[model samples]
Target: MIHTRALTKDFTVGRGEAVHAVRGVSIDIEPGELVAVLGPNGAGKTTLMRMLTTLISPTSGEATVAGHDIATHPARVRRRIGYVGQGNGAGHTQRVHDELYTQGEIYGLDRRAARTRADELIEALDLGALRERKVSDLSGGQRRRLDVALGLVHAPPLLFLDEPSTGLDPQNRANLWEHILRLRERHGMTVVLTTHYLDEADTMAERVVIVDHGRVIADDTAEALKTKLAGDRLTVGSPDVRTLSRLAEALPGARDLASSGERLELRVSDAPTAAAELLFAARDAGVPVTAVQSHRPTLDDVFLTLTGRSLREESSEVSK
Candidate 1:
């Protein structure tokens, strides 16, 4: 339900130097699709989302979101889509249900309709207990759920979420994801989100677009990006050093062969075959294998394969 061409955004701070925050990121997202934009800090993922959501004007290029031109028909685009930003959108002093009701009214609903929508969302997001509490009193996860409810007040068919679970712990992140998925199922909404969590992007999103340096680097399913862009990893750990040495020699073309204490890890094109060959070779060499495991490459591995850098490490470095 979204299309863009050479979507670029530039910024100028107090000085004269220009910052190319988003550059030529052309992408298409289909209806009823869950697509995650994966990137590290300063990677332009958020810039791209802001442009599509019409929060900021693009310096160059064009985009159509939910059947309306983002540049010319920003109001139309906003009417058809919901947006949940990284920060809390609710006012601190407003009551939880009151916040949602006011948002619904702002979206053009009458008092009765707004109240109905607010109550429905409060129940759907499991905020019944916190309905009477002030927005400031809710936990981080509760506040985020309220944000999602606010976005859906108009019942838009498309939704945009920027780092929806950024600061939440593992359990709360999962809870938010569950609510998002359920809401999509109930409304048949198309979801487009930007996230730094590699595993969440891999497991939750049907499609993944990897961005770096304000450019589109990769776009594909999580499995395709992992298997085709990256590769499977094979690791064998044995107490007998002779066994690992023999297996390493037997595998002629294995890459990234490393010794971690009693373990040997290899980045290979085909992990199962390599693991089998290692087992056979170890047997022939009279070396008993203590542990053998093969792993499918993760989304982080895909990012590393495409950009020669780790997204987790890059984000950590930027945070520091």
Candidate 2:
């Protein structure tokens, strides 16, 4: 479990300009819950995670992890939470098994206990074939799994994952999801993960928090957020821009409309009613509509409606 109140982090850049990475974020995560923090790069999700894991101190506010005060009992919080960051923690020269054994020892396990945990994690993470291989020789996905294993060898009650699926292919991503679900269902571990993938959050997280510009934009169950954007979308293709505008105005509950060369997209609050009206208006206007399709709102749609930009677009912009 985790709790934070008015958590804020600030850094002074050159010339006294302050970079507020995390600003006044307050959240409470219950035990055995999977919470996903969704955000674009530079949106402060990683900053918040780092503060919660005791990697960095907040400029002002209070936080507790697993009932231990982050500022007063950082060591206790660290012992109770396992953190798998974006970067690989294993040394290139170390073997896979040796890496985990070292982690166990650092956690205060004796030689026998460390070796036992190392072997157990190696088997559980399906790294038996590569146990003798050096970390540098492993693929990206393998290294990521090894990182997760190292974080879990001590069996912490809480886990923090920062983009755990980065650089992994579809198959490996699915495999990682299975491992994460097992940790929650079998071990009752509490998980807080930050990812750019909406599908991952939609599938794995019991609750979702969307952050942007150092602020919490939305927080709710994935289903509830999608329901908030409930409705139908109508897309029509027409060569004439004026005709597209006319159709958009004729459709009720249409908030946003986009026109491309012979294509028009509309965000409608009511799909069935708007669809019928759009067809009739097009027929009356004598504009040749090539195709018409209606679809339910998705997480992407909700994100766009809330932020005025797509999540992928925001991510690409941030990377630049």
Candidate 3:
């Protein structure tokens, strides 16, 4: 339940140079949809989220969140969306239950309803035992969950999570994912999240949007995005460099051919069909192929293929 048209955000760094954090981006998110925004750090994913959540105004363009015009009805938009930002929210001295109760009250919930929601969320988020514990004493994962509980204390229809699983262990990350899925399944809540974990996006999101250089690069279903990189990767182990070179020449779409120890790695569009050709070619050339393995392209492959670099690499470059 979010729509944006030609959204742009620019800031003047100094003299006259302007840094365009978000550039002419437009997207539509339907109700009850779990949309994952994938991007490098400076890809403007967070900036766009801020615009949608009414935390910041766009320099130009229009947006409607939960049927409220973000420019004119930001208060209504805020009331409809729960935003758990990158930073944690609960004060260090505030107890878990108190933090949630205060959040509910800020949203205009009565004491009875606030207490009820606090109790419910404390249990739902597995913070019942820590209800009386101060937030500073909680572990990173626990604190993150408490932040989410505070955000949802009012039970907003839409949730914006920016790297919600940051610093979480594998178990806690999976647990958070389960909670997010349940929110959608039971409450029909719309979730929009940004994450560095490609597997998380692959498993959780119904739609994937990739942004690069402050622009929308690709948007599609997770499967469809991976299919866009449709192909197989082949890794061959051989001692001879000549054999690897010969195999690369015979294989279509083979690039970045390199030798590591006794193995050669290169990318190919079709692994099953190409592996056989590679084997025969190596055989005729008297070069022995020790092992061959093929794997379908992953979301990382799609991102690297489209951007000529990995997501983490792009993010690092942006920070520089």
Candidate 4:
């Protein structure tokens, strides 16, 4: 549904120094696929989206979105895809239903068609109660749902969401995701979204693309990336901390060993087998084991493995 090659975007500041917002990023997204783009603040994932959506021109390279060249056929691309940006796209004074209808008309739908689309979206996104309410009066989650409705007013085949669930609480986030998934399934839309929520990206998106310093650092299915880059993690607590650390250090396939208090944690290729071996070795050495637990690798682990930093910490800093 979308393809890019060496897509680059640069900006010049007051001192004439160039800022490389997006540098040589090349990626392909297939139709009917839900892909999540992840990165820290100023990582250029948003820049890449803007270029693809025709909101900004790329400094270099080329892209085709929804079967049209983004550079040469921007209008066609816009017609074929919907974009819901980080900020609410609805006007504050407008009624919820009015906002959706207006957006449809702006996209060239006639009055009747726009109204029909507005009603369809209101029913689909569960905005019936707020149909007459002003956009400003809606809560954060309500406003976000309206924003999604606005983007889908045109019924585009592809949709681009830029952090659609940034500030909502857990329930609202899950609600919004449910609506998004239902809409995608109903319309057969190709979804490409950027999110700071690691768990959301891991569980919701079929594919994950990690961007850093304006480059595409990693791209694969979330599970594949985790399994290939970061294996399972083991957390062990023992009364004999010194002996447990020594034994854990010598375990095969172990990496990133860490210790705190009486607990030690490490990443290994196989956590179940590694934990078993460590427990037996500790038993033979007469080191008492208190507890042992193993966990599957998360998307943040994949980011840390690639960039040597925590994605959660970086995202929190960006929020700050």
Among these predictions, the greatest lDDT belongs to 4
TM-score of each: 0.93, 0.89, 0.90, 0.96
Decreasing TM-score order of the candidates:
4, 1, 3, 2
* lDDT, candidate 2, at 297: 75
Candidate 1 residue lDDT tens string, 1-320:
99999999999977878999999878889899999999998899888999899999999999999999999999999889999998999999999999999999889999999999999999999999999999989999999999999999998999999999998989999999999999899889999999998989999999999999999899999988887887888878888765576567667457767777888887877888888888888888788888889999998888998889999898888768
How do the residues 18-78 of candidate 3 rate in per-residue lDDT, one tens digit apiece?
Answer: 9999999999999988999988777888999999999899999999999999999999999
lDDT of each: 0.90, 0.87, 0.86, 0.93
- True-structure Cα RMSD, model 2: 2.6
lDDT of 4 by residue, 148-244 (tens): 9988988899999999999999999999999999999999999999987999999999999999899989999998999899999999998778889
Ranking by lDDT: 4, 1, 2, 3
Worst 10 residues of 4 by lDDT: 237-246
Of the two candidates 1 and 3, the one with more favorable TM-score, higher being better, is 1
Task: Give model 4's TM-score versus the native structure.
Answer: 0.96
Candidate with the greatest TM-score versus the true structure? 4
lDDT, residue 272, candidate 1: 86
Candidate 2 residue-wise lDDT, 237-258, digit = tens: 7777676677677666786778
lDDT of 4: 0.93
Candidates in order: C-alpha RMSD to true structure: 2.0, 2.6, 2.6, 1.4
